[model samples]
Target: MLLQHAGIRPHPDYRRLMRALRLHAASPRGELAPEVYPADVANFFRRRRIPVAIVREGNTNALRKILAQVRRAPVMALVRGPEWGNEDHWIVLIGEERGMLVYLDPWYRPTQRYRRRMTNPVFALRWRGSAFSLSRGQAQSVRRA
Candidate 1:
C-alpha cells in the first residue's frame, strides 16, 4: 500500500521480502511470530530505494507535523492494543480530524478494531509510539543491484 501510494504500481512481493529478511522463524514449540518491525521496514525501504523518515515520541513536534501532512507524507504508524494480545500492529495514518488521528487498521482480525479515530490519550491507550513517512529516495545513495 505504501509503495502504491508512492507511485510503485506493482508493489514489492511481501512474501519474498519476508523470506529474504529471514523473518517469521518458528520456535521449537511451533509458534510462529512474524516480526516485520519498524526498523525492519525502514531497512527494506532503504534497500529498495524508497526514502522514509522515522519519528517517535522523542521527536513529538516533528512527528506531529508529519502526522498532519497525511497525503503528502504517506505515514504508517506502529501501535499495540489489547486486540493484538501483546503484539504490535501497523496502521496507515490517513488524516486528522477534531484533533484526533484518523487511521486505517490493516489487522487480520476485524472484530478487534472498533473505530478509526484517536486522540493523543486514545493513542497512548493503544501504545502507539512510532511512525514513518515515505518520501524522496532519489537524494539517498543507491545500491548497485
Candidate 2:
C-alpha cells in the first residue's frame, strides 16, 4: 500500500513473503485472524535490498533524528492505533505536509496527520528512497548520532 501510494510498483516477491507469514487464521468464532510482527515487515523490505535503520521506542532524541530524516524521504513504523485501544499497527511516514507528517494508513481512505494516532511509536524502520540501506545495530536499539 505504501508503495502504491508512493507511485511505485510492489515487488511480486512480497506475495510469497505474505503467504509464508500466514497472516490469516480461522478462529473459533469463524473469524479471520491476522497478525504480523514488525520484524516480519522489516525483513520483507530487507530481502528486497532496502536499507533499514531500526530505532528504539521512547527515545525522543533519536526519534527526532529519524523524523528529520523522513522529512527528506519516507519511513515505516509500528505504532499504537487509536481505535484498537492502542494496539500495534503499521503506518508509513510518506513525508511532511504543511509542517505535519503525512501517513498512509491501511485502515483509512484518507491520509492523516502524524499527530492523530501516532502518539508513541514503538519503533521506526527507515529506508533509503524506494530502496533501503541496511544499518548495523541491535534491531531495537537506536544508536546515538
Candidate 3:
C-alpha cells in the first residue's frame, strides 16, 4: 500500500521490499551500503513531501522505534539482517492510531508465501488497539505502478 501511495510499481521477481533492496544477495557478513537503500527510499518520499525514517536494526527494537516515530510522522522502515544470507524487510507505518502495513521478503518460496498468505486468518485473534492490515490488491497495484 505504501508503494501504491508512493506510485512505485513492485518488481515481480523481487516482490517484497527487502528483496528489492538487494539485502538477500549479500554475503553472510555483508553490510548494506548506507547511501544506497535508505537514502533512495527517503528521497522518494521526500519528493512527495512524505516524511520517511529508515531504521536499520534488529526487529523488536527497530519496530519499537518505528512505532514511536510514527506518532510524529509517516514512517517507512528499511530493516537489514544482522548477517548475510538473512532476509531483510520493510514495513510501512502510515497514519496515527497504530495502524501499519508490512512488506516482508523471504529468501525461500515457502517463507515468502507464508508471510504473504497469513495477512488475516479465520480463528486468528486480530490485534487490537489500532490494527495493521495488508490489501492483496496493493501488491498487484504495485506492479501497475
Report lDDT (CA) for all predictions. Answer: 0.65, 0.50, 0.39
The residue-level lDDT of candidate 3 at 8 comes to: 44
Q: What is the clash count for each candidate, in the order shown?
A: 0, 5, 2
Q: Per-residue lDDT tens digits of candidate 1, residues 49-81? A: 666677776675755565565757567878787
Q: Which stretches of candidate 2 lie above 4 Å from their native place? A: 1-10, 20-32, 58-60, 110-145
Which sequence of candidate numbers ranks them by TM-score, best first? Answer: 1, 2, 3
Which residue pairs of candidate 1 clash? none
Residues 12-62, model 3: lDDT tens digits: 344344444444455456765322355545544444344334555444554
Q: On a 0 to 1 TM-score scale, where does candidate 1 land against the true structure?
A: 0.72
- Give the top-scoring candidate (TM-score): 1
Worst lDDT window (10 residues) for model 2? 136-145
Better of 1 and 3 by TM-score: 1
* TM-score for all models, in order of appearance: 0.72, 0.56, 0.33
